[model samples]
Target: PVHAARLTYEAMRVGAPARRLAKSLQPLAGRCDARLVYAYADHASALAADSGPRLLQVADEMEQIGALRYATEAAAYAADAFAREGRQDSARQAAARCRALNARGHGAVLPAMSELDNNAVMLTPRESQLVQLASQGLSNADIAERLVLSVRTVESHLYRAMQKLGVSDHHKL
Candidate 1:
């Protein structure tokens, strides 16, 4: 059942609608493994959020057939929903649960590093300078002043640098 749910989720990821699947599973919601049902319901809800409104129905079914893992994942999902809705307090509460679950499962807060290609460079000299200053926690304006360039020019260089490094944000650099 878990395998089936995972396959179904993958199908949904590849553009298959989950509403019909969710409806079909309604009869087995209680009889099926609760953990599998929870995962299925999560995928259904995510798909519905983007594809349609049937996810709410799936969520209702999930509530009727609950499990501990589902509750944990639901907290994380709720945090994301609240964050999207601009409800900071509710989001934080939910995010805290996610962090707790992550800690319990992995026993560490940081991602493991890979040693492969650890020392490589693809940035130009000016781009390297932008990233270096950014790593030191300098603001764009400060970096610009230090480099004797206009703030907008610094921003352009940083943008290009991040692009070349395949990162989207300064924090990633």
Candidate 2:
């Protein structure tokens, strides 16, 4: 549910009062979505703290923890918030950051569950490149440096490639 959660509050904007949502939001107080909800509310429903800056901070923290999906989500929200707040420069920067992370395969779109479930597995260009480099005995860090990707991203691509290729060993590739 967390993975699929969105940051919109359209229903709230035209419908319920803030107090009405308080009870429902209580359970999510310490969760990541709480910040998303409240930050969104802060922009529209007269809550506290500015969302643009806060969401960017949250995005950075999530990225540091390797929660790329969450980071991308937060940055996208931040960009929207900044744009709404008349902070055009910050909005563009946040949008660019969101795109960069989303390009790392952490966008809102979920992968097709049946993609890897098929008998025939196809390698994406990035996956194929990572696999080839790994087969050449390059460390993940080395590949990351050459490819301008994070080490974790390199490792993730290789892991997915290994699964698709039906190989348990990187050395055997």
Candidate 1 backbone collisions, by pair: none
Q: 54-102 in candidate 2: lDDT tens per residue?
A: 7677667667767676566666667666667866667667766766776
**Residue pairs that clash (backbone atoms under 3 angstroms), model 2:** none
The RMSD of every model to the true structure, in order and in angstroms, is 10.9, 14.0
The reply for model 1, stretches above 4 Å from the true place, is 10-21, 27-35, 42-73, 107-173
Compared with the true structure, what per-residue lDDT tens digits does model 1 show for residues 58-124? 3334445543343344444555555556555545544445445444544333221111011122356
**What's model 1's lDDT at 151?**
96
> How many Å off is the CA of 114 in candidate 2?
24
TM-score of candidate 1 on Cα atoms, chains taken together? 0.39
Query: What does the lDDT read for residue 101 in candidate 2?
Result: 74
